[model samples]
Target: MAALAHRLEDDDHLSDADFIKISNLIGQQVGIKLPPSKRLMVEGRLRRRLRALDLASFSDYGDYLFRLDGLETEITYLINAVTTNKTDFFREPEHFELMQKKLVAELIAQRRDRLPLLKVWSAASSTGAEAYTAAMVLADMVAQRRDFRFAVLGTDISTDVLDIGRRAIYPAEQVVPMPPGMQSRHLMQARRPGARPEVRIVPELRRLVRFDQLNLMDESYPYDRDVDIILLRNVLIYFEKADQAKVISRLVGHLRPGGYLLLGHSESMIGTSITMRQVAPAVFQKT
Candidate 1:
């Protein structure tokens, strides 16, 4: 068994047939396009699964994945393995700046007759960084405006990333991009004798944010229909144009009229056909 395990690890490359099968399923299910250029990356990510399943190679993993009962149970692990979760606190500083300087204030002013509770959805909220970042900004607003209330909902397709988001603990370096003074205010350090330094978002901020597993390819999302702001940033680049339109249309359905949708800077060109107008670079207001 030991020798077999060693030999299996040696045969690490994904066969062409297996690559096609896996890539097709990923596109169909998650809407992430896995071009041939991504073959090496896909193989690298799947090796961990190969080790976990004690499979000999990508071909063997593929065989198991396509078997009668393999797909239904293993699909979650597959998605988690391939879906990218590259995120940082305050990754795009300008978006949060807009939220803090103008968007939140404007939304609050528009709804002053009622107690305004802002609902911010980090639509592709990988590991909760974006959602928590938004929460930190809004929490600061609440510090001054006692009447303001907010909740953040973070959704992602990868369960592994969602679990990390729920835990709210990250390596100390990941918090460096956060605005000055916000770190000390919103994060709690976890000190141990010889462990790598880590920080957990403070309970006050974590209480205002939550994470859930949600695939964007779903026909409809089970979420509030009147979300005040939706941050669908840095995610649409993964989908084809058709899929991109479908996703934007679906997300727009959830946004209240005059609500805001913020996309990544690179994704600005893709939302022109939707029922929203660009009010700022990568920022759209629902019509």
Candidate 2:
């Protein structure tokens, strides 16, 4: 058995061909094209996956992933583990400013069930700040009205972050950079007082948002695009152009005619999409 395993180890590292296979699988499966710049990152994250499965080397693990009888569950971990998820309350503040200052005014008047409800979708809402920010905006909208219905939906590929999102608990440090008014209105410092200091969204605002796990690469995947606003921020940098087109097209199909799409400042629709028109820096509208 020891000799058999030694043979499977075959060398200390995966070959270049093996790395390409892994890259193709990620691109084909998750819509994320891993550039050569990510070589070190891939090796670091997948090394754990290899050892966890008792595989001796990455080559063995690659074969195991593609085997006809193998379970595909680990593939998700492969995607989630590699994706960057840096975000916070209004990381790109201008987009949210547009939603509050412009988009809401254009929405038909709020009238109970018939009220022009605001639905904001945070497409790559990792951890939860973006989603919660949307919820806070809508709740403030409601507080000004006699009656209204508003919803914020946040989706991501990370099961781990989805769990945190649903719980709506955040460390106090995560919120320190937010402005005083927002920090006070939407959050409450937790009771723990000392150790790391926790903070959580206030109950009323917490009730307005929901979270789910979604993969942009799933062809049959559907997004609830009937929203007043959609925030697909800071996430498209991982996808190549074709994948971006496919995901953007599908996402736009769900938007209400006058709805807005907000991309990361560094992200853009490129030349492939005709469904939206540029409205401002990092903002687009589908009409």
Candidate 3:
């Protein structure tokens, strides 16, 4: 039995057919394209799932995944395993800089007495860094101006990371890049000698943001009111161009006319069906 276990572990190779099958499943379900070049990465990530289920090989795992009973819950595990949740606070600083210097100023100047609220959406808010960062900026902007109010909605498909964001606690390294004043004002540190330090977002800042599980592939978003700013950064590159167009169109529909859309520095809307005109690098304004 020990020898059999060793052999099964050794036979964890993912065949080309298995890779294609898994890729198709991911694309059909989540709209993420796993091209041939990512075969190795797919294998490495799915290996953990195999071990968790006590499956012997990728082929066996594939069979089980497509089987009627396994189809329901395992797909959630598959997505959780395959979804990449890379994010950092204040990633791509220029977007936030643009918000602080230009976008917020314009919104504030245009605001009327009755409608003094600013609505921001962190569309792909992985682990809540981006949402909290936006909250920090908006909080500071409204600090002296009592009439100005703002709220941030952070959404992602990953339930695990959303839980972490809800906890509002993070490792020290994640908090290191934040400026001193922002850190002092918005975070409380938990530290002990000879132990790793952690940071928690203050309750005031936490109250300004909310997190939810949202899939961009859905035909429509869950928002009730049109948002003023949408941060859909770093997530478009995962989908095929056609899927990108569909997702972007749905996302843009949620934005209020004259609202702003921000994408990752590496992403763009040139080929997509999104009609918002580019006002700055990776920034678009809905006309």
Candidate 4:
């Protein structure tokens, strides 16, 4: 760890031109922008990749990344290195509160004729926390009334994080913010013989969520049926305005009429031309 940190601190090979090229490549492929202000951050993250490949500098890494064979194989590592996965269980509490207060209630009211399955897509679900949290709530609701069923799908561009999420074993600190009752009901203590103790999402909650690798920049999502609600929070800030509009439009096309779209509190649809109406701050309902 110390050696890795020292190598990261020594990454002075990220020249301005190399940074721009790398940043542009990431933006083109992932729709996430890394501006000049993020050069140091980009350098720091990619240094580990450089060390792993035994590359001497960012310039050689860029050359290798853009090479014919590198495009096919190295790009995965490149994207994994650059993508940010900062998340917590119930990171934004009000969104889930709104789900419990309004969305779930509406689903129950329409349970007679409407579809019995409530599909939720956590569209940039990093590490599965958001998706699991959604499952915990929906599972509890299902326990109360057996009239409806809910399934949560978590998707992200990072396969590495998706794998971790699929495993569902997290550091104990990850569940500390969860309410004691919820922690008990949805998670189980799993202690390995030689490893630090961890918490795993119980089998019931794990059954309700499925993770997939998805890039929001794609023209259309791979969903067979439109989703009932989408939790796409805290991801748009990484995109440029035009990219944000394009991604929003594509996501809107995947929502069932009257379904809700939740964004980060700091995000807005000010310039986007979409059919959604702002039902709450940073919350849009598809028309």
By lDDT, the best candidate is 1
Model 4 clashing residue pairs (backbone): none
Runs in model 2 lying further than 4 Å from the true structure: 1-13, 50-60, 67-71, 109-114, 223-225, 269-273
Q: Count the backbone clashes (under 3 Å) in each candidate.
A: 0, 2, 0, 0
Q: Candidate 3 local accuracy as lDDT?
A: 0.84
TM-score, per-candidate, Cα-based: 0.94, 0.84, 0.91, 0.91
**Model 1 / residue 251 / CA error / Å:** 0.5
| Candidate 4 per-residue C-alpha lDDT over 1-287 given as tens digits, one digit per residue, 9 for 90 to 100 | 99996775585667677688778888999999888888888888888888898987777777786653576777788888889999999888888888888887875575465548898999999899999989988888788777788899999999999998899988888888888998989888865523666899999788889999999988888884468889888899999888888888888788877788888887855423556777777778887
lDDT for model 1 comes to: 0.89
**For model 2, how does the per-residue alpha-carbon lDDT over 206-254 read when each residue is reduced to its tens digit?**
7878888898887755656477778888888888877888877778777
Candidate 3, residues 161-249, lDDT tens digits: the string is: 89889999998889777889999999987766236778899999999899999888888887945688999899889998888888878
Which candidate has the highest TM-score of all? 1
> How high is the CA lDDT of each candidate model?
0.89, 0.77, 0.84, 0.83
Candidates 1 and 3 compared: the better one by lDDT is 1
Candidate 4 error regions (>4 Å)? 1-11, 67-69, 192-196, 269-273
What would the per-residue lDDT of candidate 1 be over residues 1-287, giving only the tens digit for each residue? Answer: 99997676666687788788889999999999999999888888888888899876676787888854688889999999999988989988999999989888888887855678899999999998899999999998899887679999999999999999999998888998986789989988776724678989999889889898899999999999989999999999999999999999999999988899999999988867666788899999987
Residue 13 lDDT in model 3? 78
- Superposing all C-alpha atoms, what RMSD in Å does each candidate have to the true structure? 2.2, 4.6, 2.5, 2.6
Which is the better candidate, 2 or 4, if ranked by TM-score?
A: 4
